[model samples]
Target chain A: MPVNKPFLHGQFAKRGIKAAKGITGIAVLFIAWQIGASVSGVSSYFFPAPVDVYNAFRDMMHKGILEVYLLDSLYRYVVGVFLGSLVGIGVALALGLNKAIAAVFAPLVGFFYAIVESAWLPVFVIWFGYGITTILTLLIFVVAFPILYNVLAGIQTLPIVYVNAARSLGATRWQILREVILPGVLPSIVTGFRIGAGFAFRGLIIAEAIAATSGIGFLIFDGAANKQTDRTIVGMIIMGLLWLIIELAYLRPFERATIQKWGLVTTAEQREVQ
Target chain B: MIVNKELPKISVDNASIAYTNQDFAEPHLAVKDVTLEVSANEFLVVVGPSGCGKSSLLAAIAGFLTPQGGSIKLNGKQIEGPGADRGVVFQDYALLPWKTVLDNVGLGLKFRGMSKAERDKIAREHLALCGLADAEAKYPHQLSGGMRQRAAVARTLANQPEVMLMDEPFAAVDAQTRMTLQEELVRIWQQTEVTVFFVTHSVEEAIFLGDRVMVLSSGPGEIKAMVDIDIERKDRDLSSLNSNPRFQALRDEITRLVRQDAA
Candidate 1:
C-alpha cells in the first residue's frame, strides 16, 4: 500500500511554516523578557517589561505624540531620499559618460564617501543650524555617496557589445543612453538605492536625536533622559518594526519586480546548490 | 553570372586596423593592407585561423573601428561611423535582457520613431520569418543558444539595412543547431536582397554559405586567396554537400590554404 501524505505538503505549507517559526521566536523572546522583569529586583524605570512598553505606546498614541513624530520622521526620510537619489543618479550619469570629468571628480567623491555622515553632523548644524535644513543635509549626504559609487561602477562594467549592437541598429547617442545604458545599469541602481535608503534611515534617527526637536530619534533620547524608560523602549520597538515593514512592503517587492523578473539575480528560493 | 558592371556595393581600399591600449607598449595591428570588394546582394564569407584579422576587417566595415590606413566605402561613398545602412549580428546575442524578444526586434524601428502598433506588426513579421513567433514575449536569457541567435538576426533584419555583417554568429551553437541555422540563413538570404559579409573559422560553413570565400592569413591579417563556388544556391544543403564532387574539391583547396597558414 502507498503512503498518504497530508494536504499541506507544498509551497503554501512551507511559507506558512516559516511565518509560524518567526512568530514563535518573537513570542519566546517576549515571554523570557517578561519572566525576567517580574523576577528581577531592579526598578521598572530601568528595565520595563513588554507590557509597560505597550502601555507607553498606547499613552503616546492617545496623546497623538507618536503620530506627529512618526509623520515628521517619515516626511524628512522621503524627501531627503528622493532628492539624494535624483542627484546621485544624475551626477553618476554625467560623470560616467565623460572620462575627463570622472578622472577629476572620482577621487574627490571617494574622499567624501570615506568620511562617515556622523562626523559631518556638527559641521552641517553650524552651516544650516539645528532644524529641518541641518537634518536634511545630513540625510542627503549619507544617502548620495553609495548610490553615486554603485551607479558609476555599473556604467564602467557594462558590456561593450550591447552598445555596439545598439549603434549598429541605428541608435542615436541620446537613444543609446536612454534605451541601452539606463536599462543595462538598472540592477546596480536598485542595489545602490537599497544601501542608500538603509543609510538614510539610520542617519535620520541620529540627526533627529542630536538636531531635531520632533521625531522618533528625539522621542527615544528625550524619554531616556526624562527617565521614561518605557517610552524609550516603545521608540526602539517602533524603529525596528518600521524597518521590517519597509523591507517587506517596498524594497523586496521592488527587487522582485525588476532584477528578479528580468532574471539578472536569483532569489533565495531559486538559488542553486553548488 | 550576375554582371559586376555597376559600382560594387562595398569597397575596402588598403584598410588597416590597430588597437592602442596602455597594456601594450605599441599599437597591436589586427588587419594590415587589406583590400576587397563585395558586389550588391553577394554573400561573401571570410575564413581564417584564430588571431587572424577577419573579425577586425568586418568591424572596420561595420564602422565600429575606424581603419587607421585606408577607407571603406558603401555605394562609392565613404563609411564614417555605424549607420542604419549596415547592421551587425553578433556571435554573443546582444539582445537586451530586460526587453522581451518582440521589444528587442522592434527597438530599431522605435528609435526611428515608428508608432508602437506599426513597429510591432513589422517586428512580428520578422519574428515569424525567423521561426521565433512563439518566443515574442520571452526574454533573451529564456531562449536556447540557437533561438537567441535567430532573435539577433531577426532584430538586425527588422532594421532593414542594406548590408548584414555577421561576426562568427553561429560559433556558439550546438552542431545540430548550427547546421539548421546555416540552412535557414541561406533561405533567409535568398528571400532578401541584402548583402551578407560573414566572418567565420569554419571552412565547410564558408563553402556552404558564400558565393565567394575570402581566406585571411594569421596575425595582421591580409587576404590569402579568394575562391568562387559555382554551386547553385538551392542545391547547397549540409546533408547533400558531402556527396557532391565539386563541393569536396573546393573544401579540400580552402582547408589546405587555411591549414598552410596555421602551420
Candidate 2:
C-alpha cells in the first residue's frame, strides 16, 4: 500500500465543520482587537490595530523585505533543525545501545540541558561573533539535547518481544536495527522533532534578535527600533501562522503516517482521523 | 511407529543455560546441561513448571540464545545462528500489529526475494490453510486471540521452514479455542511434514500434541523423563483423540512426572 491515501472521506467532512467554527472564533478575536484599539485610541507605537498590522504586512510584501526575511528565517530553521536531529539520533543510539557509552555521556547531556537557551546566548556570541555559524551552532546544541534524550528513552522502552521476534526471524544485528529498532523508535523521534522544532524556532528568533541583519526576528527588532508597532505585530503574527501551517500541512501528516505504519498507535477510532 | 530412514533434524548435547550479571543485577543459571535429539517430521513437546527454562531451551534451539556449554547441530551442521530453515511462533501471538493478515504472512517471503505476486500467492495459500482467507484485510487488533495465533502459525508456515519452534503458542487463548487450535495445528503439521518442538506448562496440551513428551524439572531445568504417546494415529481426527484411553494414560503419566518434580 502507498500508505498516503487521504484519510477516509468522512474525516474531511467532519473537519470542515470544526474548521468553520475555528474561523468564526478567529473572527471574534479580530473584532475584539480592532474595537479595543479604536476605543483606547492608543498611539500606533504602543498598540497597532489589526487593520494597521495588515497594512504593514502589505507594505512590507510590496517592498520585498518580508519575503527576504521570511525566506532567511526558514532556511536557517531547516538547516539547523536537520543538522541537530541527525547528530541527536546518532548520539542517542550510541548511548541507548551501550551502557558504557551512556554512562560517559549522560552526565554531560544533563549538565547542558540544565543551562537555559537565553543564558547560552552571551557565551556563544563571545565565541563565534554574530553570524550564521554562531546562530546555527547554538541552535544545533539547544535543539539536539532533548531529541537525543527522548530518543534514548524511546530505545530503552522498546519491548523485548520485538527484538526476540526479529532475531528469531533470521534478522542479523544490522537487519534488526534497520527493520525493528529504527521503525520502533521512529514515533518517539518524530515526537522529539515536534518538541525540538519548537525550541529551535524560539532559539533562532533569539539569536536573530541579537545577531542577524534580516529575518522575522530582525523584523521585530527593526520595527521596535523605528517605533513601528504595526510591523512588529505583523512579524509576530506571521511567525505564529507559519508554524501553524507547517505543523498542520506537513509535520502532523508525516508523524501520523509513520506512527500508523509502525503499528505503534492502536486506537482504530482515532486512526480514522489520521 | 512408521520411521522413515532420514538424518535427525537437530541434536542437542549437554546444553546448560546460565546468566552472569556484572553491573545490572543478580545472576543465575536457569537450565542445567541437557541432551536430546529431534527427528525430521517428529512432534516433540517439552513441558515443565514455571521458571524451568522451557522457553529458554526453545530459544537456544532457535539460536536466540547461546548455551553456557554443549552444542546444537542441524543435519550434521553446527547451528551458528537463526536461519530461514527454522521459524518460531511466540506465546503472545507476536503478529505485527500494523500489518494486515496478508502482509504479516508475506513478510518472510519479502526477505526471501520473492516477487510480490509470488509472495502474495504463497501467503494466501497459508492464510487459507489456517481458515483466515476472508480475514486477510483485518489487522491484528481486529482479530480474536485464536485468530491471532492462527495468523502467527500461518506466518511461520509461509516461510516454509523445515522446523517449527512454538513456545507456549496456544497458552494465552481460552480452552475452547486452544483445543481447536491444537487440532488444526496437528492437521497442518501432518500435511506440511514440518518438525515441531513445542514448549508448554500444560501436561494435557503436551500429551495431546506430542509423539514424545519431554518433562523438565524446576529452575536449572533438566530432563526428568520422556514419555512416548503411541495412541491411535488418525492424524486428521485429533479432535476425538482426546477421548482415547491411551491418550489419557499418557497424559496421567506426564502429570505424575510434573507433580513428582514439584514435590
On TM-score, the leading prediction is 1
DockQ of each candidate, alpha-carbon based: 0.76, 0.44
Candidate No. with top DockQ: 1
Please report, in order, the local distance difference test score of every candidate based on alpha carbons: 0.91, 0.85
Per-residue lDDT tens digits for candidate 1, residues B1-263, read: 55445889999999899876687799889899999999999999999988788888889899988999998999888999898899999999999888999999999999899999999999999999998999998888889999999999999999999999999999999999999999989889989988999999999999999999999998888899999988988678799998899999999999999988894
Tens digits of lDDT, candidate 2, B1-263? 56446768988889897665475376667789899999999999999988888888888788877888998877757887678788999999778765688988887887666798999999999999998999888888789999999999998999888899999999899999998999899889989989999999998888778999999998889999988878645632556666777777787888888887674
TM-score, prediction 2:
0.90
* Candidate 2 Cα misplacement greater than 4 A, ranges: A1-7, A126-129, A261-263, A266-274, B1-6, B20-24, B112-117, B235-239
Candidate 2 backbone collisions, by pair: none
**Which residue segments of model 1 deviate by more than 4 Å?**
A1-16, A268-274, B1-5, B21-23
Give the CA lDDT, 0 to 100, for residue A261 in model 1.
69
- By summed lDDT, which 10 consecutive residues of candidate 2 chain A come out lowest? A1-10
Write candidate 1's Cα lDDT for A17-121 as tens digits: 877987899899999999999999579898999889899999999999999999999899999998888888988998999999988987898888889989999
